[model samples]
Target chain A: MCSMKVVVCVKQIPDPAGNLRLDQASHNLVREGKLILDESDSYGVEMGLQLAEQAGGGEVTLVSMAPNSETSGLRTALAMGAANAILVSDPALGGTDALGTAKILAAAIKRAEPDLILAATESSDGYTGTVPVQVAELLGLPSVTFSKKVTVAGDKVIVERQTELGYDEVEVGLPALVTVTAGVVEPRYPSFKGIMAAKSKPVEELSVADLGLDTSEVGTAGSRQQVVSVVPAEARSAGEIVTDDGEGFQHILAYLERIKVI
Target chain B: MTLNVIWVVVDRTGDKVATVSLELLSKARQLATTVEAVTWGDPSQIAEVVGAHGAQTMHSVGDLGGGLPGPAVGAAIADQVRSGSSPDAIFIPQTYNGRDIAGRLSARLDRPVLTNIVDVEESGSGLITEHAIFGGTEVLRASFTAAGPGLFVIRAKSFAAEPGTDGAATTDNWNVPDLASTGAAKIISSHVEESEGPKLDEAPVVVSGGRGLGDAASYQLIENVAKLLKGAAGASRAIVDAGWVPYSHQVGQTGKTVKPTVYIACGISGATQHMVGMKNSKNIIAINKDQEAPIFSIADLGIVGDVKKVLPQLIEALEKRN
Candidate 1:
């Protein structure tokens, strides 16, 4: 068995391209219906699988916290070749902010005892972009964010972290946390055999108590920030629509000139 | 009661400050009674610019070598808070390093971080922040319930950078604490992605392509039009994920957020993910065959036609004028 153990954090979010509904009473996303693995987390899962493969022989474990004991998203990651999954589901997790979510994930990660941790830079739904770093901090491990490329050597992990202009080559020792950006790798589709195997793949379920987290500290009661109000963005007034009758390009040119962009 | 706010500055190559840092400094000045600028590297390099941007004091953490010094920088700032010089709030850019620092600081202080904020305003001696959610379809206003030291990681171009007439800022050295585990992560080497044209985020004009272009070869139409207009070429997340273009060209919620003067969308259906990046552009022009495409919802000028035909005609029109 390979000594390298990796834990990848995956999230289940409402399909961005689908029609979404919100809970009227609490003003929260209605996440109980038809949730799938977030597209953003696919890159991290792919990176984890690739790194595990590169390490000669290792297992890729997935960790997630969703409402209603959702195993569909975790199973999807397992179908992509993860060895096992751990899900933290409880009503107390409802309305938990990014920091609270991080605390729970950090505790679960400690139980997995992986040498490396991988996560997406941001979630499709929440998009907080702070949880991975928060997990790293809570676990007291070195962390790197926005990695476009990652490779593992004997006891050291090297990554090309994306910067505003380009990328910086960063090297970190084992037991480090890294967040991957989208398009970092081409995610693979699960095969028939892999899908079949995923059904039997070990999925360990835990709750706030199992993770040694207090309900008061893991839910809305523990949230530091509160949404005061939410409003729809100002609808963009429809503009001129020109049919392409040979003068279409001319109209565009004139518009650009009017805006002084040409 | 005067509020003390700290704004983190990111230094670009050749010692210039990032535009987002200056923007934060400008906004922070208006929100707080005193705005202090924190940065790594030599203080003299950015002291004048930061001061002009409304910073009264400049805190320098010296240098922590080549690789990113996120842990060390965060530790230094946390030390300042622990020493009883705690500021009421701290603002950090949404860059990679900025997020790292914010995360580390939040962990150290056991505080919550309000991230991806686009606006902030003072309310009753505290601050309220606004964030775009659901791919910019809705806006949410949030505030801290507990006392702060509220930490925020703000997006670029959310607020325009305006320099004030303030004089040079007073400089002070901050003692960077020893990093126990964070020191292990070091930079081996660095490489900048090679591109000949203007950057997507900085370009005044941007021409972006989407999956509707059909194939990779058709993407050249976008590049050609961008070159003719002296703009930069961009891509939708769909095309970028499909490997039709580099990730640097992606413009969306997950990609670079651009607010160019003029943005041209070619055959893009304008998914919420893609619209979030360029919705703030001064003028948006979309060319797609689909009349019901969402791109037209926010576009200033919409052309209902095939991109394959319209792009060439538009290119010819520009060429003839030149």
Candidate 2:
């Protein structure tokens, strides 16, 4: 059986470091600044590499859609052993949410006819794990989501789905999608040899037009959804710490009982 | 009359309804006597159940899974907007499925959707709903000025539903056709993972482990306690990143945000990601060998003791109570 072609859908977003920020007028994460590949997306990249390696001979392509600096994240993927990388960056592709991002990525996957699509279960800042499922929906591909472990048998992709309570064993036909969890595989550090080789690998930068995606169908315009506003959640008041000192503890217990904590 | 909107019950799966469906049914009856309910999946005889909940007549969409996301339950309500008799607000449990339904419905119906509301009260123009945000750090109230229906999603356990609320009408048949072609998406199949413990989102007691648990085997201490109490178990992203817990068990900014009544942290050093998840728990207990651990910042009870030693005692106490 031929090895499967895997595409890891990655997103470059604002670094979560100063995540709690208020823009002057918009009260949003100001976009005129630092952005990086979402950290969880690295797990998706790592899973793609592992799957490709286990299959003997195949390619793992890291694909992203955003402004041009998004390619930096692709380099991180390249460092991790992705066979090739692609960045769909253009002013037109800016501010795309999960649905819009998926539309662009689905188009990119169709170009290579990948057997499997991998993505992180969630983004660090946006915190919405909605993209992978939405993309699978658009591509009409079956999805085994929140997957902690993944395997392949012929053309079937088997995975263990991570859920709120436990895990499930599921197998879907190839040309499927999986949103990877941290349990899937530990991402490899950029080895010196891999870093040298990554330079030789292909990283073709493309614009929204190259994917045959109506750029209007991308970004805020393409998004059927929008975060109407972003505000730092209200601050928490300092709580009164209580000690279990007999009578003093009784007061604490009364307070706890009032809040029904005990 | 608080508009007493009675919602029809539909099973989440393609088959029979669940107990939570009845819970929603009872709550919907309490919401209003007008009883405009939307029932998806096996809508037959739902009106009978709806009628018993004080519904004037239940609104039902039949044989729903013709090919739709499970959240079509919300879209059906949106698409079947009625003649001056639609609900002023729509309420749903803030489940993963429920949130999606509320989001999609809010988008399609052009209403404001507020999630994780614990209660609703009468306000100046409409209703004010309360939500727990920034973990459990703050409680906030919001009211919509929009004229149409306001959408709300609450946890299933947030309100207790009493049965046989005398005036409930029988489950009525509502056939909503518009949901069939509203979106270009459909769920061919959905296989859920089998998890131990109570449904994490709805659980009252939750115990979490973190990187300090040291190894995967060490998680058994947390799991043992969870099993004894049949409560949910959680993990910090550090532990999830360290490979001790699956991402699904992760409680943090990038993972599931839960508000259990009692949440216990064992060996977890509270990171921002971790705090965002369990911050809303009514009570928090932290057991870390490190007295300097950040988990103590949010813990109502802090024990500067080894979790490996402390967990066994906690499990025994809970088991002894049983």
Candidate 3:
């Protein structure tokens, strides 16, 4: 019914479709490749845009913690109609874990003074699935994760929180955080005109220092865990692959018998 | 390194403790000299089960008063650590509440959390955790470089849960601190989807369908095969996102992690996200129209066929055999 300032936590990750290379030294995904808006974050962007639109006023701002000052991903979201973006990029943020990332995002999000904060339940690449809640805890705000559906009513937000059994109707006062599940909404593709206009969208770049975070509080130095070893998981040996020869079910039946499940 | 004390976060609904909690307790017992358990509800309800799993002590924050348990419960545990009973590591099952509590605790303590753990061990007084990445293709072993009480959020079925002769755990009450605004979120109501047969994660056999099942009505084929097999029905995120099924049936990253004895994936083009959840199944069978679907890479038997045709034939054959 009024202005709804929603801040969406977006992640600029290496494209999943492309070859992924792990950094030999850091044991993290190599950032040398081009970065794109993580597909999971698009759902949150779309959800934020819709919520702001339904309220008839206000704007959606994007907050991201990325390497190499990646604005390419932010531009895509901005083109899709986010008003502006805040990017926290610093060499010191190379190996930030979920909690460390949360601290940085929470700092930037506070600057936006949003009524609601939205993020994907987890990033497509990292899949840590804990940042939004950690950010909420850091900001002293209540959080609801895995929201399949969200509604804003006055100063409170009602969410259909996805759970193991089904879903729970969760209600939290505004100025809270909610992590949207993937496919909660279809993200709109940037129109040609929108894309052209996005070139001028404001993307404010900041560093760890800008956020007043000490170097030892944000990155590899601040990371509590270190990769001890990396090894290939034991691969499942390939088995027989057959085209249906009108008796495919027989093979399944025989296999079941061999396994003695039938 | 042998840990002096390890704590397992027990998740329960009424009297039934989550299998993952017992699994963690078992693993914790092996790694530490002492294993403890914590929960949000009455510690007595799960005390015997947790004790049998090797938890020597149980802690509870009592009822959450309709509030989400994360903030209050997390703070309670943090208070215990601040007051002196600091465990070497805290093992949390990778469930909805587990992640929330772990995240809250990590934030409150200014520590980092290692999640998606598939295996954990103690080496030189610290804990090492293994995580499957890129759809279980690679495993990364990590260890906390910081201080005590390393928080680990582990996946289900990562370890065998065996019961000891221990009868009951010594119980203690943990204080729920003033949560301020963090405890304002409340579960106003809840719904549990009506499911028959075994739960998807607990079933010995699981039959899953994806978008290739055509329409919402075709999902019945998945349920039919699962029923005839005395298994559980699951779905890929694509169909669940398409609103064809409830989220309870989704088997994938961001969904349920299931390690059934046999997993039959029908009409599902295996994405890494989907595979992450079910790849650990003892045996995998994928039937997809596309031979190139990644599901075949791990499937013990790959059948390239239309699920519409193959499912009916399989269902009929199963019925006749029964």
The TM-score values for the models, in the order shown, are 0.96, 0.72, 0.97
Q: Indicate which candidate wins on TM-score.
A: 3
What clash count does candidate 1 reach? 0
State the weakest 10-residue window (summed lDDT) of model 3 chain A.
Answer: A17-26
- Which candidate would rank higher by DockQ, 1 or 2? 1
Please list, in the order the candidates appear, how each scores on TM-score for chain B only: 0.94, 0.75, 0.97
From the highest TM-score down, the ranking of the candidates is 3, 1, 2
What are the lDDT scores of the predictions, listed in order?
Answer: 0.86, 0.63, 0.90
Per-residue C-alpha lDDT of model 3 across residues B1-322, encoded as one tens digit per residue: 2888988899875358989999999988888889989997778878898999999989999989889878987999899898998988899999988999999999998878999999987677677889998888888999988777889999988999999999899998888989999999999998877689999889999999998899999999999999999999999988987889877888988788898888999999998889999998888898999989999999999999999999999999999988
- B1-322, model 1: which lDDT tens digit per residue? 2465655555454357888888898888877778888888888877899899999999888877864757877889999999988888899888777888888888888888898899988788788899887667788888899885899888888998998888988999899887778656887777777886788888999999998899999999999999999999999988988889977898987788899999999999998888878898989999989999999989999999888888889899888878
Off by over 4 Å in 1: A245-247, B9-14
Report how far residue B154 has shifted in candidate 2, in Å: 7.1
Pitting candidate 1 against candidate 2, the one with the higher TM-score is: 1
List model 1 lDDT by residue over A63-169, tens digit each: 99997998888888999999999999998999888889999999999999999999999998778888998899889898988888898988888888887667888
| DockQ each | 0.73, 0.13, 0.77
